[model samples]
Target: MSETAVPLPAPVFDPARVRSAVEERLTTFLDAKAQLAAAQGFPAEVTDVLQDLILGDGKRIRPVLCVAGWRAAGGCGDEGPVLRVAASLEMFHAFALVHDDVMDRSATRRGRPSAHEAIAARHVGRPDAARLGMDAAVLLGDLALAWSDELFHAARLGPDQLAAATAVLDGMRTELMYGQYLDLLATGRPSADVDAALRIARFKSAKYTVERPLQLGAVLAGADVGVRTALSAFGLPLGEAFQLRDDLLGAFGDPSETGKPAAEDLREGKHTALLARALRRATGTERDLLTGYSQGVPPGPAEVVRIRAVLEGTGARAEVEVMIEERRRQALRVLEEAGLPPAAGAILRAAASTLIGPAR
Candidate 1:
């Protein structure tokens, strides 16, 4: 199925408007942190990096989802507490990204030096550039992780709501770590089952990216069993589609648009659904090339092009696109069935559009 075949609603909240609100909230949160750091005698550069990571240019999708989920659960559209929760999610995300970049040995993120690399670059005279960078980045990630709980605790949630949100946060962190390990493990093996690979992708990337954020918001709003169940039903499939979209971007998205190198996932030997499907469909020389191409050092541009050709020739790219569309449709169906408040559901529907909707 073509991506255009999916019917997406007009987004309920303006993307620009939502983004502005998120930015304002993030600024407030970061400014307060900067003051706290200043009082503690933190170096200016350290505080700057922290603020940059927090207030950097991101889609702000997680926090938006949290707010949307809360609204869907009949919570008021108050920005104060929601912003704190959002900051917590964002902090946690920074923690994940810093560590993920370290594990992948990635040099750039969002079109700039990654946190660890940035820190390392500042210490040119240091005896251990890589080690120092890694260590500094790890420490920064830990700070973000710790701040996540502090923000969560500071939110004006009741005890029960706070407990529930904490549980979701804990599960998300643990599951994501496990998922990352599974991804690393898959690279060593010659072949992977497509279904199993999809499961891992869902757990590792999708839940953390989409499901947990929505669940966190819903729980904060004290959503009932039916409401929470509906949100999960809507979130899981949509989350999977979100990851699938990312997988496509990793392989084929423009480096300029995605703010990362094209085929970076392949370079990291990520065993995504697209790669797994391609491997399944490849034969003879194509299979040999793929097996050899993914191992050892990263493939150069010529090799990456060759790998793309194999994927295209085998129709794996098209097949994965079809799967992406299917998952999107399933998510929409769940939302339609959930019978959420029209306004809230509309916002969620819009959020889904923004998430998986095709690029211009």
Candidate 2:
């Protein structure tokens, strides 16, 4: 008689487990990078700073979504390759955040000094310490980007998978740069153009943050067009909601929780959806106050108070909350219809909740 054959249990989707796995891979990979840098006589600061940023506090949303996408697309084998690619996305994010901080002149990230700020402190005695910090941080950001590519290549994906992943990544990077450029031009000149604000959110956050990462993992599993479409249907709205939440946090969140200064968005004159709504709906002194602040002037504490009052009085804050809830619903609806495995769908729902639910 032939021996009885038994099937292994299907893999369950656990967001915490996925996050842990991705974090482990990132730590290990960056440790190796640190070692290589030392061996090559590279500045210890480069590796040390990167290690802090990469292994520090983050939700690891992109990587978790990547794994969730793979699971959703019927991937049922080793997670080794998937985790590597996911880690690459985190590295790329580190690059993005570092550059973003430099551009915004932000002093804090993850509740601590940003890369440039930290670098400056290290060379405090130098006459050109500030410039040196900025330049070195830029190089560090570049290195992170390059190392991200290295991570992706080192994943050793097959030719077909590599091609697919490459296409998505290239598009994501291009979209991000274009979005940032657009944002740069619009900053300090914010208008009531809700559509334009949403456009920025789409490219800067929706596609780059949520959609592409999901697509990358889906393609890795040989997902079909339907799965790709489903991921987009779910990803776009959720990503927008995520950014909107960020805008709110930037404006009003407790600095202790958000790891950044409150009203920094107002100070930077970011053309966010919230600002657009305030610009549209505010009247009289509220309108003038918002208009004045939107002209690129950094708001002092009193000015920030007035701006917050306008944001609240104009109903922009409440409107944004509603928008977030609606987007969350839309994403959940798509997840329901996607016909993904039960576990995968649950994980996606959890991710959506994490993105749009509340501040952490």
Candidate 3:
């Protein structure tokens, strides 16, 4: 087995181009909405926050997937409605992030203070900074959730297609919530069984991240069940590989590149595959070092380096890299078998390769 044997499709469509197109469309929609809100005498602060959240830095992968899926499923329509649906996904994602940061007590998002903390920082002298910030962010998140539903309702799909797409969205939300609970449970407990941890990662990270977004697009485009199933076969493994790579970066990636503290996962005592493997394979003092260095308010940088050394020494890093390669290969196999539109599949294949293939 080669370390990475996944054959990617040619780049039929550039992801950066697709991302730019989607961002422009979303900005237009948001600008129109902001103007309408201003005409209604909405608070400027509210409108500003809404606009910033919508136009903030993001990869815009979900909506792009929605549009791509629509194209792949033989849908012939203006891209506008599909873009709205995709933008709606972005709003829902904002809701998730706001709440997630609050739960994780994270200080930053996309290289800025998190929504709650940002607002809190503005009123540092106020006695209720934390409360005010949390309240504002909660309402903001709620607004985004409501907007997502409204946008979905306004999409161009027929009644049956609309119902099917909405159902998928609901399922995605439910599964993500459950995955979060599983994550909370796994922390500060006995380390999850390796296989079980992977299962949780798939449901929590992979499905919501990739499979659901693609399914939404396919569903809205009225794809048959066979097509939808085949896309899942491709999306699930690719999504899992994506998260696995994220786990590696969380521990070992340069902070300048990744925009988060390195070894933050270790500080959080995250039971990722890397950590689980280290726990299982380390011997004597290395195992003791890992166990001892796993938790605290802020793990020291030297300890993080030590943890990395332990992971490398135990072959866990190599194992994880190999697993990522295998998952990518499996995803490509599914894509080849799915008989999707060659051009669309080619684009998706390239996106997946860029997402999960070895770093350049």
Candidate 4:
């Protein structure tokens, strides 16, 4: 199977092109939903807020990966179904982000006010506007989740394709929820448990972000077990590397570039692998500072500076960079061994390189 002859895809098989296609589908789907809501006399804000968030700045990574997976599996011809599925994944991601913002009490996302914050601003006159916004945001997230399912079902796959897609989607959703729960439980009380942190990363970001999206596309193409396995080999490690990079970004990234506050992870006491590693190595003043901050000591400017110093001084940041490089190498090796056709291999390889590059 590794040596099976495969035809090359068109040169137009570009990430930017695929992203445009996926966004178009999302816009059309959401526009129809908005019309339906209007016809039913539902509040326009529901669809309006959702539209703004959905159409906002995003990398469109999942959908692009899905398309790449299909190509890798040697599936070709009409891309309509796969494009719809990709849009569905993006919609599901919206749901996740919406709820996550409420959970973290985040003020912004993608450089703009978060869903709850946006909703709260709408009812500034109300005394309980903040609480009402949060509750309403939760419902909005549920609506997005439901709409994701609607998009998936409307993709119109065959029986076998539907069954395969269902297996992957079901596992992805369940694992993501479990990972999120674990993360919530560990919040504000970080431990020096690198393994636990990695476990959460695996389920929450790695598998959900990369592996399952690839599998969803592969299965939709009727990919064999070997093909599925190969994609996992490449996707899982790449996904981990991506999350590791994200952890670094969350802790030390520039807000201008990342669109999130620098050291936000430390401020929120997120049990990231970077923090876990730092905790394992820190002691005396550094250890005391991290512990205090992790245990509800609000990180003032001084504390943020001290925490950054500890993370850097302890070599935790450097070690995470090492981890990212290692995982990227592993993923590239798998891509080579998988012997995917040239176009698909190029797409996946480029994705890895772009997503898991050396931190500046």
The whole-model lDDT of each prediction reads 0.80, 0.87, 0.77, 0.88
Which should have the higher lDDT, number 2 or number 3?
2
**Which residue window of length 10 is worst by lDDT in model 4?**
291-300
Candidate 2 clash figure, as a count: 0
lDDT string, candidate 4, 1-360, tens digits: 478789664654578988999999999998998999999999888888888898988899899889888877877889999999999999999999999999888888888888999998999999999998899999999999999999999899999999899999999999999999999998988888998999989998999999999889998888999889999999999999999999988777778888887677776778899999998889877877876755434677777778889999999999999988888889889978887777778877777876776434
lDDT per residue (tens digit) for residues 102-209 in model 3: 766666677667778877877899999998888888887787788778777666677887789889999999999898788877864425267867877887789988
Candidate 3 wrongly placed segments (more than 4 Å): 1-12, 32-47, 190-192, 283-296, 358-360
Deviation in Å, model 3, residue 262 alpha carbon: 1.4
lDDT of 2: 0.87
lDDT of 4 at 344: 74
**Each prediction's TM-score versus the true structure:** 0.90, 0.94, 0.88, 0.94
Model 1 regions more than 4 Å off = 1-12, 293-296, 358-360
Residue 31, candidate 1: Cα error in Å is: 3.2
Model 1 agreement with the true structure over 252-347: per-residue lDDT tens digits: 888888878868877666778887888887887887766674554667789878988988988888988898888778877887888887887787
Which RMSD values do the candidates have, in order?
7.0, 2.2, 6.9, 3.7
- Between the candidate structures 1 and 4, which one is better when assessed by TM-score? 4
- Of candidates 4 and 3, the better by TM-score: 4
For candidate 3, the per-residue lDDT at 310 reads: 86
